[model samples]
Target: MSSKPSRCVVLFTLLAVAGCTSSPGKDFFTETIDSLHAKTSPLRAGYSGPAAVTSASNAAQRFNGAQYQGTGQFVSSGAPVTKVTGDGSGKFELNLVNAPIADAAKAVLGDALHLNYIVDPRVQGTVTLQTSQPVSQDALVDILQSALAVNAAGITSRGGTYQIVPLSEIMASTPPVSVPSTSPSGPGVKVQVLQLQFIAADEMKTILEPITRQGSVLRVDSTRNIITVAGSDSDLNAIREAVSVFDVDWMRGMSVALHPLKTSKPEAVAAELDSIFGTKEGPGAKLIQFIPNDRLNSVLVITSRPAYLARAATWINKLDRLAETNESQLFVYQIQNRPAKELASVLSSVLGTTVKTEGQSGGSNVSPDQTPIAMQSDGVTPAPLTGPSPSLPQQDNEAPAHATVVADVENNALLIQTTARDYQRIEQILTKVDVLPTQVMLEAVIAEVTLNDDLKYGLRWFFENGGTKVSVTDVAKAAAAATLPGFNWSYATDNIQVTLSALSKITDVNVISAPTIMALNNQKAILQVGDQVPILTQQSQDTGNGSAPIINSVQMKDTGVILTVTPRINNAGRVMLDIQQEVSNVTKTDSSDIDSPTIQQRKIQTRVLVNDGESLALGGLIQQNNSVDRSQVPILGDIPIFGNAFKQKNDTIRRTELIIFIRPHVVRDINEAREVTDEFRGKISLQTPIQKRRGGTKLQQDLKRLAY
Candidate 1:
């Protein structure tokens, strides 16, 4: 052999050895195909042939990790690769004649590339391509995708393998609920399972499906009564806790029965229950229902939880206790101020209860013969009493009355028996009656005024009717006569020293003037009188004569009094008045002159308690008497004394008296006060009598006017 041929042969042998080592054999390809086919084997039954074909292509691409760049043969009859070309422009040429897609991919990519087929077992399609052009792996994928579009085919790579799937299936699958985690769970983090009993499979899916994205798996079985969850410790714990609320049917409820007490009515109890657990406003109507029994003797409470039923039962018990308290007790009232009969009348009218008076006449009782016997249940009439029937029992017919008042008129007491609730109402009514109209007490003073004869005639007081002033020209003769001892010149000088004391029933102060109306609630009066009086005091002064009287200082005398009165009203609508009265008087005594005149004062005071409209009269005061004398001569003395001849002697006596009156009225309200004051407000004015027209008779006027 030649050396050149031997070198070429050795080089060829090295290249063949490199090719055999670098490129996989048919067995490697077969193994790759088997792996891909196994991965996509499940999809073949569910997907079309084209879909399986696309999956197999993806499987090969994923395993090889290389993209097809040039012409690739698919489904042609010839060697796996008839032509191959490579250039730096990313361009290649290859011929695949009558070969499957797997071989075509291997030829196009490189001699070292391996192709795996994962097509459907039933598929008959093949790849045949002869081209010289620059093409990308994606372009080849696009061509395959177009062919598989009719069958709704898709591909997915996982675990270094491609799986075939229908396009519709790919589109229909939902995105993961949560993103998968890249880092592994820490130590002590273990997968846990949560089982749901009451929740439906679909609902559990919706609630826990989100954990799938966080590397958790939720396995639900509709046929089973439980749901299984697998996840990390923390995630599984969270899901288990959240799903517990939904594990039990909260809509399912329990029922409680109740019996009505004696004091409580079924309808009333039902109303209260409704208020607490409303049909529409509280906790969803379907969760609570109040169903009354047919006889209304019991009530059924339907509630979602036992707690609700317990709360309702507590309220019902409280209401029943209150009602029972009101019904079981008795009330009694002892009235001291009001008369028994009157109180009984008030009780009957206000409370609508019958009242009985002690020592009252009894009604006639029916004889046993007149009374009919009740028939027995066996249709036999009961026999009458054998002996004469005693007088009917005192309380025989009182059973039907709610209350009975035993009125003792003599002792003025009322013993009552009634319910406690009724007593409250009775008390209120009594308060109003106690404030009925009250009367006022009245007190008055009457006095007779009299003047001493010494002052009346000796002083020769002048009157307004006619002045009687004596001339002093005759004073000298009178003075000479008065100077004689034991001469009777003064008229009754003993009476001048006498002082008439006033009766002890006069008051100087007055409160609440007469003709005033006051309410019965407030009835008290205060009176005060502060009157000023001038008095002349006798004083010794230096005069011409020793110890002679002269004008001295003038003094003021306090002749005023004060009175206060308070009235007590009784239940009889009458008033008892407590009165205190005082009076002061200053009287002037006869003296030599005005400056030497003596003054004396008298005070009258009294206290009396009397009934309404009662009168208090005061008397025994000073009196005054005056007389005038006149004389006339007969006609024979008609000369200078003729003026007195026509007159006859005559004496006239005059008397004067003082009297005071007081009256009071008690009113209940403003309207009553107004009516008392306006009692005579309405008056008819006096009118002139109408005169009748007499110019014509009735017949004459009728005849004249009747002319057509």
Candidate 2:
């Protein structure tokens, strides 16, 4: 029994410990106290503090999650026949229907609600509504909302009361309210009266009234030009902002007129305007629709912002100025052989502006009120009296018939329009394009190849029958006597000699100088005469001294010929040609010891002027080719053994002549060029056709017999 009692005591102790463990301690309680103190301290010091609560009191400011600033009844579609009643708890109710919505609502809810209703005497429709069973107040309100027009009336409750009235009546009867001038916050409805001097009061009312709700009242006094509005501070501030955009002197209606210089049709101008301003979509919380004007090219800027009108005016004025300049000055020109489309492109490229063209449409050709003439039959031509005719009457300051004219391009002509000052410049450019190209005649003769006089096998036989070795010195001495002064030597030889008399010997090779020729269509061009003419080489002594060994230096010389010419055209389409020619004979000498090349040149030059289709001949260019051959006499020449007997030598010389011919023709027009081409074609045709078969003529048969 004692043991059982001890077990019971242990169980009791465990229960106590468990209970103690489950409960909070003094530290946790102290923390809670500290937090309470921190949160309450501000409230005790007379500040509202953060919106929270330890207890609810009339003086304590607390915020509930589901709450609103003011009390209000709800309505939709300009009616409140269905009541909207709600408590702080989430419960609501609705009542009677089948009557004027605003009147029934006012009777049930009283003045607590703000109602805005405008009575249209012309409107006679009645709203009928019924419910089969009880429903939430929201359902009843929704039913009423579906039956009435929102623009006519509405119901709103504030300050713990409900009211209903016509939208227009409420807007007019509500007391003026105030809103903070700078801050758009705080409690209560605020009213503001703004007197607009520039914007019409009616217009401001139209813009503001539609956007305000039942809680907001907007009134306009046309005579005083003032706007009176009342609403929640936020709603009132919004209305004020909207008014600010259009409350300006320019907003009344700004118009700008532009008269383009070219008098474009109204439709065309309208298209241009549409291209610029474009479409925009609004008024008060809605899109401003853009409507295009079909009657005029002018755009009606139906916007409340002045800047848009100003910007559009600036663009239109700029376009107008351009049109003015385009029309103020005019020029017309006729060009042949150029199409209108092609000419327009050329003008656009050259002038950097748009150019338009029309198909060869002939312009006006009316004679100004001409006198009547009697008709004559029989196709008889009237004969003029063989005497001076009387002078006709002349009108004062009247321009001649030819003075004023329009474009006519039926004869393959281009009609051009430009400023008066640019007319001459454009004319010159067209003339250059249309004028016939100048024909240049050229004549040339390529003379013989450069001379190479060295031995074919580097061995020179002095005599054919010597049959014995000859010293190179003796052979060099003999060749030196016959060598021309300008001939080059391959091997350097001591005691070399050249005869001055050889230089004076006139060869068949013609020498010439470049021509100083000039030609001009209108003005003379810079001449290149005598610029590249070859110069004759002067004689010089060798720089090497007679010593142990000597090195010969090489020299450079100019070779070949140059010719220059110019043609001048006269009024009669005749070309006078000036010509110059230069001829050169050059020789180059090189030795193994020389570091640089040697050259020498001899020149003959001449100049003359000739007419078109004339020929100039230069006859003095002649070249020579020389060669020597050796053979044994008959059988002795062919025998390998003792074959050196009776050797013989033969020398040969060949000469060539070079000549040049030139001709030129001046063409004035397309017809002239075509005629020349046709004549040449006729000649070709004559040589192409086969003739009828026949026996050969006497001259042809004789030539054939000689060939056989």
Candidate 3:
């Protein structure tokens, strides 16, 4: 009994120590109770005014924080919360925190402007907004509407009252949408009519339906191909911009269009397209067709889908370019400034084909054996063969691979049966060759100068001056210098008239001819300023028995100054002239047999290169030592010293030199050619009046002399 009592006492002592160690602290237990109360307690209602507080006895019955509640209530601290505030100037301020959207809008519109409003029961959402400054009434309404829109609600003014409704019921509650004569204002619903050009109205409506608002309406008028949308201004504008992108030619579907060709033929292009996008049959095959309108030079495209049309249009644009290559086409190219036959020959040579004239015998590539023969009139006679028999293999040659070029003389066009690539090359060559040739105006002056003591050597010596470098070259020397042959002497000068004028001052200088003529490049021009002399070629012998011997023959020959010049202009504007000039005259009639006239002729034929507007002088045709006799009396002229007083005897020597000056001017354009023509006209007009005045004076002198 004693041992058991001792063990019980020890166990009791240990249990008391363990209890003391596990006990909770006073501060921690208090914090735990406060936290549990704060978490589980109901929310306290905010005090607004005296009405929010119950009667004093009722508040005393309700549990207070620490003691009995008093009658006065505490107002919240810091800035006072105002759902909406206005400055009476159409500007308002709002401080809403999770407030109902309807109450928020009513506070802004009704409390500020005293406006009536109706809020739908379905329009339920809280808006949180806190403005730092005042905003316009329209801006405040816009903010409210945007907040409403985010919650699938919208607001519209109807009958002078704001109606806040769900987006699904906005159109039903508001007035019917109409096309506004002007732009709609203030975030209200609007109506717009969009006319589609390429896409159908119903098709565009399908595209816009997904992005359209729930309250908006998209109506299509198929007959007019127009879509009418009733929505907000923003939505209408977005639809308009989208329609512009989708309603284009490239976006067309199941349509027909015409594309005109500029450089390529429509038939050939259509054929090429047929080879590319060929016919297809079955489901999902592209429905496309190309038809060529040859008369209008246009192609018609028919397609069933926009994608196929866009693909075909891209190819059409590529193939219809200027000078696009193609297969064979029969094209009639109008010959502008060249002969069709000559141009055809040039084209044939360049393209390696045979030329065919309009009415030539073998104009076609068809062989004689291939040509169909006509039946004979009689039944018994067999049809005649158009060519040799088949036994002759040499005559039965194959037709040429390249078609011949046919020349249409009547129209002055070439009928080319060739590919577009070859025709493009041919066109380039034709543009170069078939143009107006350059024209050159050649002016020549032929003068005969009676040499005096001052000009003893020649005109060359007279023309040479200190300021000018005159190169006097004889025929042999000119040939050695690569100058023109057949000219006796050549010299270059700036002005040939200056030398002639100076020579005329000392001696007689007679201008035989001054001729000016215009000739095309590589064409000949002739100028004759003298008479045609009849020459007796044969003399009639007195026949022993004849009545009057018939005069045999007389031939007419051109005499005096005659010039023939052929000018060739190079690309560098230099002229190569092949000139043949002749100065011939009947010196005297011979008293010998046939009484033929003796002719003195001086001719020069040569080729020379001269720059445009430069002058070339050709000379050295001289007659020297010509003696003239004068006698006062026949017997006294031969007598010695005393006879000199009785009769004067004089022998004069005459010397004459012929000089020709040539100058060529190249006329580049019509303006320059007109200027040259006007200058020549002025010169002729001046000379005509001068000649007339001289003739009148001479006539008056002759009349006065006759009267005397």
lDDT value, residue 502 of candidate 2:
17
Q: List per-candidate RMSD values in Å.
A: 28.4, 33.6, 23.6
Give lDDT tens digits, candidate 2, residues 252-307.
45443343323223354445655555532112211111233444434344445555
Q: Give the number of the best model, judged by lDDT.
A: 3
Q: Per-prediction TM-score, please?
A: 0.26, 0.29, 0.42
Q: At residue 401, what lDDT does model 3 achieve?
A: 26
**Rank by TM-score, descending?**
3, 2, 1
Q: Any runs in candidate 2 off by more than 4 Å, and if so which?
A: 1-154, 157-206, 209-434, 440-566, 572-574, 578-607, 632-635, 638-648, 682-708
Task: Please report, as a residue range, the 10-residue window in candidate 2 with the lowest summed lDDT.
Answer: 495-504
Off by over 4 Å in 1: 1-433, 437-524, 529-560, 566-576, 584-617, 620-660, 666-670, 678-708
lDDT of each: 0.42, 0.40, 0.65
Cα-lDDT of candidate 3: 0.65
Clashes counted in candidate 3 amount to 0
At residue 532, give the lDDT of candidate 1: 65
Which ranges in model 3 have alpha carbons more than 4 Å from their true place? 1-332, 335-417, 461-477, 480-486, 534-556, 587-599, 623-653, 674-708
- In model 1, the worst 10-residue window by lDDT is 491-500
lDDT of 3 by residue, 444-550 (tens): 77877788887787665665543223343333335523543334567655666665555566777776676778988887899987888778897676788578767
Ranking by lDDT: 3, 1, 2
